[model samples]
Target: MAALQGAVETTAPVSRLHEQRSYDPADFGVPTGREEEWRFTPLRRLRGLHTDAPLPGGKVTVECDPAPEVTVENIERGNRRLGTAYVPADRVSARAFTSFAEATVVTVPRGVVASRPTVISVRGDDPAGAVFGHVVVELEPLAQAVVVLDHTGSATYADNVELIVGDGATLAVVSLQDWASDTVHLSHHHAQVGRDARFTHTAVTLGGSVVRLAPSVRYAGPGGEAELRGLYFADAGQHLEHRLFVDHGERNCRSRVTYKGALQGADAHAVWIGDVVIRAEATGTDTYEYNRNLVLTDGTRVDSVPNLEILTGEVVGAGHASASGRLEDHHLFYLMARGIPYDEARRLVIRGFFGQLIAQIEVPELHARITSAVEAELA
Candidate 1:
């Protein structure tokens, strides 16, 4: 973990992270090679990996053209608006908020409608130390914006991001991860929604030696809405995991999540765990979650768990679903009999599984890019 620490210390431009509590790997629970959640996961994959350390310069090359519709700013507001919150104090004594000294803050002004999608590219060049980066996004009332974050690096690193949506605002965020083969990636995303606000998040993971993504979202005000979507593909000897939590704390709030993944080749594993909680006071709330996985090879494995807890029966709707299996022979046979090749038929099915989530995105360019990425992975 010294490598991770060094990255955060030197690369992170924000200054306030030092004030917040720090996080230790043991705080989340060590992999016993026996726990149900860690059953399908291969903890041995992380053996001999470098410890988490800080990056040298805390400088990452961002490669994306600026957009005219959105405004990107830098902030060090000494406020804990975007930082760690869910970690138990007893297990971890890390700061709640750590600002990257060279952080980028994006703000969408009230009543503004961004026509083009904004792209933020974070590229890491250091191979020895961890790189800590923070991005805080705030949307004003009645504003509509679309933001895309792309993370690419040559070395192993850890990144943290925080997002806040104002009342009556609409923000769609799409994150794409394409790391190098020797990279180890860990990301934490926290979002807070206000009254009548709408937040939509879609994540696509395509590359990395070991990748863990955690997205925690909460509806803190009335009439807030959140939709979360994710897709991942793991090939030979790769390990990918996605963990999500959605909390409804206000009345008349709504949330929906759908995530799908595909694993191929020997020793490849993918895991998805989704948890949704409706508090006692959150009446008239509606929430639903679903997770599905497609195993492409005999040696590949997938684990999916969808859970929901409701405290009040007065809520409108609450449900969860999970499924993990291989491609259906009947469907493949039907396509093959119709003159389509078996390989192409399988590709079509995999595309359809992920296409469901990509279709929900409103940005045309982003949708095309995600679709193309998925197709390329299949090819």
Candidate 2:
């Protein structure tokens, strides 16, 4: 019954509770690992973010290089522009809402197409501290822009990101969680697509001791479109999770999600939860989500779940798929028989699996960097 009418998000996945939005942290309860949303997560490793951990500022730094047509500003908390496109959906998210000192706002003027991609670099210098951050991106009507959020270094971080795509605009956001091995990160991303607008979100998570990313989308008017693509790799003793929600509340809107992941070494774990909801008002809605995982070694864990909730069947179609298993022997054998060494063949197989998705990225530098990082992860 996932073509959902209402549901709440948590650390583990999307739960069946009625959805609620709030800026107050006290409105959300600390997850005890027993709730549906917190079941698959390791709560102890969250650095108390789900509980009472102090969300200090200045522990992490954010730098942005915007295109000539774009404007970037750092505004203090309580700014009206900060939460217009976002709402706290979970405990860590609520905590982040109350903890961040300043929020970064990036705006693309109406009808202006950005000449270059905006690059926002976030780095944590202290592994012993915790940080909270917020970022908002607004694309005015008919504007087109691409934004990249890059995370690195070590720290316990919780952050929220908001994207507002105005009518007829097209916006793409690429978020990378290439943190240090000892880092822990919790992030929430929300996008509001206006009438006839198009939005694309890409999540590339490759590092960190624990990384949990939740990205959700909602349509403001009819004919909106959304596309979500992601790829992640979990190594030994690492926990990487992604939770996605697509709320089709407007007529004739469409959404598509495709996520791929690879796991290796003992204690390497990955989780993917895709939730697509076609509300009663969302007639002629079309959506599909699929997730695939590759197991590179024994002693690895993969949890993949796809949920499609259709409130009104009067329109288009909805579907989802999830699968996880070891590398296909036939594919490997076929490559090896082509005179390719076993190691080279294995890497080639992985490259084929993720290359297509990465190719969709419009940013050349970020695209090349992710390709190199994927190669390094395989090596």
TM-score of each: 0.83, 0.95
List lDDT for all candidates, in order.
0.69, 0.88
The per-candidate count of clashes, in order, stands at 35, 5
Global CA lDDT computed for model 2: 0.88
lDDT of 2 by residue, 1-379 (tens): 1122112233332324328788888887888998766778899998788996554443789999999999999999987878888889888898888888889899999999999999999998876778899999999999999999999998889999999999999999999999999999999999999999999999999999999999999999999999999999999999999989998889999999999998899999898888887888999998999888888888888878777777887768788877787777888899889899989999998998999999998787887899999999988
Candidate that would win on lDDT: 2
- Best model number under TM-score: 2
Worst 10 residues of 1 by lDDT: 1-10
lDDT of 1 by residue, 1-379 (tens): 0011001111221122112334543443444555433454455553322222222443357544445756776656344544533331111112112324555777778888887878888786765544555677778888888888887776555556667888999988888877776566666676788899999998788788777776767775899999888889988878888877787779999998888888888878677767677878899999998877787877776666665667788899998877777888888999999999998999988888888788887667767877887787778
Worst 10 contiguous positions by lDDT, candidate 2: 1-10
Clashing residue pairs in candidate 2 (N, C-alpha, C atoms within 3 angstroms): 2-309, 3-308, 3-309, 3-310, 12-37
* Model 1 lDDT on a 0 to 1 scale: 0.69
- Candidate 1 ranges beyond 4 A from true positions: 1-59, 63-66, 76-99
